[model samples]
Target: MQAAILRDKSGSLKIEEIEIDKPDRNEVLIQTVASGLCHSDLHFIDGSWSDFAMYPMLLGHEAAGVVQAVGEDVVGIEVGDHVITCLSIFCGHCDRCLTGHSYLCSHRQEVSDRPIGKPPRLIDGEGNAVNQFTGLGSFAQEMLVHQNGVVKISPDMPLDRAALIGCGVTTGVGAVFRTAEVKPGSTVAVVGCGGVGISAVQGAHLAGARQIIAVDLESQKLEWATQLGATHTVNPNDGDPVMQVLELTGGGVDYSFECIGMKQTAEQAFGMIRQGGSATIIGMIPIGVNIEVPGTDLFLGAKRLQGSMMGSNNFKVDMPHLCELYLGGRLKLDEMVSRTISLDEINEGFEAMINGEVVRAVIDFGT
Candidate 1:
């Protein structure tokens, strides 16, 4: 199958014919129907993030696909099922997984890759091992992943739209619905207007936030946010976004989300939250970058600064529920897809993401 392969940091993905292994016990082979080009993918492609990325890697995780085959040991999922792939793989027996916090499971690596002596799931035409990013790696025509990463969804859901739920939507919406649990009628603010940020706006809306403030430097994105669910938009170019948010929310918002993943924006999100409100950082701020907040406020005001990973999701439960929301016309997945491109056009998709030209550009592998 033809796949996009990245061999180095800060480099463009080159489309090439690659090799995939057959489904082993506990694995499922999926025919990639649609994969969203996410900012997390851009982070590794552009070298801003590289903690888990392996060279000669297949770098896509947010996707939905049709199951082509499943290993004999894989239970509860079968071939012909439509599913969304999640990177938050877990071992069911881990303390975190046993405690309903599977997203924080420590044994996740065991699910993504086989043991040391086993053959690799992906390889170059020459048979060199190629890492599948987060084990799904949907930038290609096919993927072989553990059942833990696959979430079966209603087949009626559009694969293209369902793809967003794997990551961006899950992270953003999960942050609002699961993590912070923003109260209905409360005021909320989200910084950044990218796909994930816009999804956060939708989440705030679903939570019934009375005032949804969207902040960004781009007017186009701010407009997009408003259409998604933000009751108000703020362009940082106009003035300090923190002050703007404070002014709009009377004193401050009940909750704030930092979706941009920058040190400055993280602090700004912290600054705009009400005295006792929480600020959830959903963006993947670079490793080693520390965000500093007011120390006195931590004690005096009882403010909270928290980090959310992949919206602290339980894929088996969350993905299907999210799909129902989309099918009912409640979740805004249609508007989230700015464009769809073929696998060969993958580089263009990432380029568009870097330029902030699209909300979520999906790769239609069948194309």
Candidate 2:
């Protein structure tokens, strides 16, 4: 199998021929069809989150594919099923999973990875072990992952678009539907108009938000946001984004989402929300960076600032529902994909993402 490996934090991905082991008990082998290049991956590539990087690692998580085989212990999934892989692999017995928050499962490491001392799931030509990022490494032609990490979806769904639901779509839409529980007719503002931010715009639209404001520094992205569903666009280059959002919404929006992982944008999201409103941080801010908010505002206004991990998703149920929405012509996944490239072009894809040149660039493995 050919996979993209990040040997170190040098800000590039190298495509190499690697070997993928057969499925272990409780695991599934997937012939990768499509995978989305996400900002979270860029975080490690660019050294923003360098401390978490495992060198010689296969790096990609948002993916969808056909099941090639399944281990004997895998029950619900079988060969020939179409599925989306999630990073939030969970242990069913964990307190978080039992409490309806499997996305935050505390026991993922216990189940997602192969036991220590066992042969690695991936290996280099010299037989050195290569870590699988988040245990899904969909940038490769094949993915070996735990059964709990995949969600079976209708075969009718297009694999290229279905790949988005694996992460970006799920994270953005799930933030509104599950984490924030955004009410219909609510006023919403989303900072950053990239993949996740654009998805959040679509989520707000589908959730029946009366006013959807899209914020970004790029005019092109704001245009894309408007076409997708944003009622208005805000470019910080013109003026203060927080003030512009406040002026547009009459005071502040009912809910705000920070999709760009910057201390400034996260704080601006807090500023854009009205009293009693909630602000959800979906982007992964670099480790050690702190975001400061006024204590008096939090206390007196009853405002809430919180983080949403992978949209607080329960992929088994939420992913299938998202697929139905896409199939029903309600959710717009086709518009979200800006380009489709092959696995060899992964580095260029990430460069485009860094430049804000595309909403999403997917790698079509042609399986």
Candidate 3:
């Protein structure tokens, strides 16, 4: 199959005909339908963050597809099913999974990839092993993943839109709906108005937030945020975003979500929340950058700063429900798709995202 391979940090992806091994006993093969370009992937692609990712890696996780085949040991999912893939691959018996925190599953590395002795799932034409980013690698025409990594959704859900729910949608919506548990009638502020930010805005609205404030430097994103669910918008160009949010919300917001993954924006999220209110950091901030917060506020104000990983999602349960919301027209997935391109246009898609010219650029492999 043809796939986009990133062989270096801060380099353009090279399209190559790669070899994909057959599914393992616990694997499922999916014909990729659509994959969403996410900022998290950009972190690794642009060299801002690199930890587990290896060279010549396949770099995409936000995706939806039709199941092409499944190994004998794979149950609960069958060929022809529509599903959304997640990086939160879990082992069901782990303490975290048993305790309803599968996102923190202890055996993730153990289960998500092939066993050490096994042949690699993907390889170059010269027969070199290629790493699969996050073990999903949805940037390709097909994805072979552990059964635990994908959640079957209603086939009625469009694959292009379902792709967003895989990462950006799930992370954004989960941050509001599950992690912070924003209560109805509360004031909310979301920093960043990209695909994930817009999802956060919509999630706040769905949770019945009295006022959803969207913050961004781009007027286009602010406008898109308002269209999705932001009751008001704040452009940082106007002035200090924290001060702007404070002026609009009377003092501060009840809940604040930092989705940009920047040190300054993370601090701003903390500042925008009122005393005793919670601030959730949902962005993948660069590794090794320590975030400093006001020490006195912890004792005097009772404010909380927490990090949310993939919205603390249990994909099998959360994704299906998300699909229902989108299918029912409550969640606005249609407006989230700014553009659709073919797999060959992958580089252009990433450029658009880096330029902040799109909300979510989806690569339609079938295109």
Query: For all candidates, what are the clash counts?
Result: 0, 0, 0
Residue 46: error of model 1 in Å? 0.5
What are the runs in model 3 whose C-alpha is more than 4 Å off? none
Best by lDDT: 2
Tell me the RMSD of model 3 versus the true structure. 0.9
lDDT (10s digit) by residue, model 2, range 1-367: 8999999988999989999889989999999999999999999899888899888988999999999999999989999999999999999998899999999999999877998988899999888999898988989999999999998999999999999999999999999999999999999999999999998999999999999999999999999999999999999999999999999999999999999999999999999999999999999988888999999879999999999999999999999999999999999999889999999999999989988899999999987
Error at 284, model 2, angstroms = 0.6
Q: Whole-model lDDT, candidate 3?
A: 0.93
User: Model 3 TM-score?
Assistant: 0.98
lDDT of 3 by residue, 261-327 (tens): 9999999999999989999999988887878999887779999999999999988999999989988
In the predicted model 1, the residue pairs found to clash are: none
Query: Per-model C-alpha lDDT, please?
Result: 0.91, 0.94, 0.93
